[model samples]
Target: MNPEKAFKYDVLINAEDLCDREFEQQDFLKRAKAKKRTIVFAPRRYGKTSLIKNVVGNSFFNLSRNHLVLFFDLMDVQSMESIAKRLHHGITQALSRRFPVKTLLKNATDYLKGFSLQMDMDPVTGQPSLSMNVKGREVENEMTHLMAAIKTLSQKYPTLIILDEFHDITFVPEAEALFRGVLQELGESAVFILGSKRHLLTLMFQDARAPLFQYGDEIHLNPIALEDWLDYFRERMTPNKIIIGEEELKWILETLCDVPNAICEFGAWLLDNIPSGMTLSVGVIKQSLDLMVENKQSYAYMLQGYTEKELDLMTVIAKNKFTLEPHAESFLKLIRVSKSTVGKIVKKFMDRGLIEYELEKGYRLSDPLMGHYLATR
Candidate 1:
């Protein structure tokens, strides 16, 4: 091995085989098979995207005469027309991987017909240029051609449409209702797997007046256990190729709060440093941690709806080892609010989905994954 170096490429850590999350995977797969449109809810960086990626790779469902999985991410998309265009493009990408678009979209209407409901992107500065205008107004009729296309395609291939950041679709105003309506009409013919961060989805469903209300099976993605992670790392480490000491491993896990993205960041950092056959150390880890923290401080400012007192309380919870629940003394002092007052604040936050609580105890941030930020600044 080379005598000395600053490590190699960067640490690259990931589940050995996509870590198929049991409850989530089984729930959605079953729903999809029953032709039930489903929504997967999870906060950012909690592995929603990763889970979808894993499902696609698993082939647990058949593509021939059963299910054809089509995945799309709306992270960069922004408008109504953009929705139709993006779905057209996403489905086309999935189908055309083997079939040609020219062959499938034989008619002008056929071009716009494949998209039942679309997640819009701003016409300008979109990730990919999509032409989605078909015929009719914003009403259900407007989606006829696109709906027809998806129905036709499913007859032959049985599409499993996986939409990422589906909650964002609501920002397009009228898009959510139309999409949900389409789901109702599709029935057992096709399946849609939609995922979003939080509140928006619940709000849509809670409001019985909305078309999307109680539309599909709601599945929550969960964090992987520490024990599973430890076992995984042990299997992947080979003394001659890469070495990860127990202390360094523990430090990495503790600092990141088991966040998938943070774990990935540590892995990437680790990969960049590992020499052909050398072990990692504390210094390498500290440097990488600083880099990640430095890059992430901006989000702290972005999460600015809270008051100073609230922020301080959040900090306390962030640093504390106590449970996230109600009537907890430590949490009360951390927020510096009286019992009832803290209850009000907690209720407000719960309504906004900024935090969550156990029915019997106290509250914590709505998303546990955001706990990663506490590790930083």
Candidate 2:
């Protein structure tokens, strides 16, 4: 954690916890009361989970009478039932553990037990588990049962389900149907705050023909304000506050595009390496950037979901360090992609928010890390 960094590992520092999150408090209250669903889409390492955790931590919402926030991050979960039951149990468990749910959800525990619900945790860690039939029809039934269970809880208590790494649902169409159904059925009584790496949900809804075709307030979690990042770093400085040259730090942020996670990771490296930790010079910052660049594969993994040509296009954009939105035509020549296929790939990535296109500006990486990875990978 290095304690004194703009941000740190395992820390949830978002707008909600900044002494006053009142600016967005109204929207939070409305979402809580209206019970709408939000799909949060951002590039990798953007603190999607941290922001939601912060939202739940904010006393204005989490402690309110009409709200129960359940956050489930299925980053590593590969199966569906494990997701189902964990979601099922997480809602009720969070209700009981985090809040005064006895009054909000009567019977509290027994009412849930009465549902005849059954679930188990992953064998290794004993954390709640979920799995689905690989090639059968069981997923539909599981989804049905899972939704039925979540809805049952909503009947008793106002519930806000925050699903992180939500794009994982794309792996199973059955899961998508189940989620779409949840959005359809839960309506204004329940709030869904979802987080995903890409804008898959946007495309799913944006395409009028898709079943899950509707969307409500779509919030893009931006980089943690740079000032906040620096202030936190100044406070967290350990041993002795390590003074990083402003220009060097600015260069790092400019290179990284002010991403909180990367800032924390880079800061950690610098903090641990400094001999006296009194002050950091431009060379020290450059050294950290070198390490981050050398090990670019770590960040590049996030884009592994994209195809090879897609990677090629990204590589060009990364090398050039262009913006997210650019015309498809320019990319065709740069990546040496075939004219026929370039249009399709560009359209596909653009629609997915993987890249953006501006009339005058040409195309580029959606974020700095993605850009850098494309350049190096």
Candidate 3:
């Protein structure tokens, strides 16, 4: 076993720490400053959270010190009421950070009259905490008030509200209709930043029959270039007196499909678990791969929720590196299921956010690590 080192590479990095997402960051800032409604998307664990946190939350475009940025993560939201509460809380949190407590309370109460706002002392910390409440029909009314408040703030501060995992909004019944109606009424004063799973976001924003169709400009966040990641890896490794050759860097990128988070995580493992002042070699790489296989057990556990047929279908997917047409004779013989049954299985996996399909790429596993693990296993 290699002796552990103290140095750690964070999987979640700030924009300054981020490697080569300049174009995506600039596009986002440009659309936001112009008050254009925009939707940004990428596959899960592709650093959507990191980008928004560092770029928007850090206010890269706030040159005048006049824009208020409110960020909300809808990943945990399951209902309209929860959305209202989160929005109300997110706005309050942003205000509390920028202004005095007394001023925050007064402004919140005045603008968000639909929600009762007050300041209370924390029992344990003896710190002042803002409390807000909206019940029953007031939830809807307050959601509208919240948008209006944001619009009002935008006139002075040019507010930008980023709702991460915005596609989750579709899970709540009639939530899309309510949001569309409210945003249309609210106008362009406040810019909306929506980040979500690419496929679901496309269905929500690009599908003609969807309520929010054509409502926002769409941008895709691509994986970082291998050259940029190579520099990042070498920079991180050299400071620890550890060296990684070009071939090793290329192997890591290819194995991880150039996804930023996975690469950083494995790199963190190499930095922290390997002995300090020791150069990384192919043996160390093998050890890392072994550790990765151990992590794949978690993916295996996830597979427990699936049926045997589904498991076999996943095997077929992994073996092929892409899903073959269900009706194709070779595919049908391999899965030993009817074409309609295979179609249903594929749809179910897609709905569960486990698969993606493209004409050029065919069907792909959403988690590249999972696909790699399953393929080798």
Off by over 4 Å in 2: 1-7, 10-30, 33-36, 57-67, 74-86, 92-137, 167-171, 188-190, 206-214, 277-283, 295-312, 323-329, 340-377
* lDDT (Cα, tens digit) per residue for candidate 2, span 1-377: 54322435547666633422344445655666666666656555566665555654344345556555665665535678667656755664665454442352444344344233324555897655332222224755655655665676566666676777666667654677667777677764645455543445555655788886666666665555556556556565544557755576677777766556666767666666666546766776666666666675665567668778877766776676654433456656677778767768876775555665332344555555556655654
- Per-candidate TM-score against the hidden true structure: 0.65, 0.71, 0.85
Rank ordering of all candidates by lDDT, starting from the highest: 3, 2, 1
Which candidate wins on lDDT? 3
Q: What lDDT tens digits, residue by residue, belong to model 1 across residues 1-377? A: 63332211123222334443666666666666666666777655566655554553234335453355666666535676677666666655555443433543453344345233323443675533224444566634545565566656555556666777776676687777666766666764534454443556677765688666777767666667766665555455553367767787777766655455656555656565557576768787777666655566555775686787666656666555225564578667656688887667665665454564432334445443355465346
lDDT of 1 at 247: 80
| TM-score of candidate 2 versus the correct structure, residues matched by position | 0.71
Q: Indicate the worst ten consecutive residues by lDDT in candidate 3.
A: 1-10
All predictions: root-mean-square deviation over Cα?
6.8, 5.7, 4.0
lDDT of 1 at 198: 54
lDDT of each: 0.57, 0.59, 0.71
Task: State candidate 1's TM-score.
Answer: 0.65
Error of 1 at 172 (Å): 3.3
